[model samples]
Target: MPVLTLNADNRKELAAAIADERWVVACLCAAWCGTCGSYRATFEELASRHPDKLFVWIDIEDHADVVGDLDVENFPTLLIQHENLVAFFGTTLPDAGVAHRLITAQTELSAAQLAAQADSSEERRDWQHDCNLRTLLGA
Candidate 1:
């Protein structure tokens, strides 16, 4: 599937589509960043390759309310989630190949393993409570 750009027009569809996904990959970026502009195509390519996963292009500046309380410090930051558990959340290089591998690795984890990781450490536990897109955006 194509990348879903979350804006006022399509936000509802994106939220609904995410209901059946095993994982969600959200690229948090800003419209004005040149790096973000360049990374857009790569993100789309990744989305095409991973049709089962929901890929959301969130322009932080445009969707601040949706991103509430989350501090995205750099361009192309990725928030990977499985259900309400945030498996991974951080900045990454703007390379589809790298993201492809990361996504594959993340998807391979069993549900039990993912749950363990989400509470294995204090930081990880915080991720479970804080970084969930469902909680963050009420979707």
Candidate 2:
């Protein structure tokens, strides 16, 4: 799926949508930015890989008011949110491999938290193993 476009009009809904979700990745970008345009395809691919997670693409120019509070200084910036909390930001869009690794890491971390919340020991253990293996493999 294409990255969901966010703006002042739907900022509240976007926040509410991601509030209880395990993970969300928001891309702060502008339409005229070449880098942002280039990264869109990869971002969409990642979003497709993890449909459960909210992938928001915000056009900084179009939604300056909403993003003004963020004080973002660069284009194509990435922010990873875990349960409505910003867990990571300023991660660069270097390449698809790097993007995949970052998304996988954040998703695994969020999954661990979700597993804990559900009180599923088996699920938690499985996530832990998955994380450990990913780390060991340098993914």
Candidate 3:
């Protein structure tokens, strides 16, 4: 899919999409920044490659309230959100190869981390149940 020009119109739908486990790559930029303008094409190319991930180009000044909640301090801030958690953030945009690598690594790591958490929770529950059984049997 093409990079989405995020405005007030589709903001809620975008948030809902992200909340629904869809990965979103939000580029927080300002219209005044030359670099932001320059990277528009590159960003679009990246978005095109990853159709499953929603790519949103947000003009910081135009949407200060929403960007403020993101705690963006720089002009061309790249925030990658997978599901509800922010997977990556910072001013890493000069090298496209590095950016791609970082995003993919984060996505995989987040998946692994979540899976591990679920496994741990299941183990804890099983242990607790075993302990309860032991207590009932006076062991």
Please list the residue runs of candidate 3 whose C-alpha ends up more than 4 Å from where it truly belongs after superposition.
110-139
lDDT of 3 by residue, 1-139 (tens): 8888867787766655555556777777888989889888878877877788878888878976555444566656787655544555567754567667766776667577744533465443342332221121122
lDDT per residue as tens, model 2, 1-139: 4577875476666666665644777787889988889888878988888787778887877876555545456766777656533445664754777877887875676456644533455443433333221121122
What TM-score quantifies how close candidate 3 is to the native fold?
0.73
**Per-candidate TM vs. native?**
0.93, 0.69, 0.73
Against the true structure, candidate 2 has what lDDT? Answer: 0.63
Each prediction's Cα lDDT score?
0.86, 0.63, 0.63
Which rank order by TM-score, best down to worst? 1, 3, 2
At residue 57, give the lDDT of candidate 3. 85
- The best candidate by lDDT is 1
lDDT of 3 at 14: 60
- Reference-based lDDT, residue 95, model 1: 91
Error at 47, model 3, angstroms:
0.8
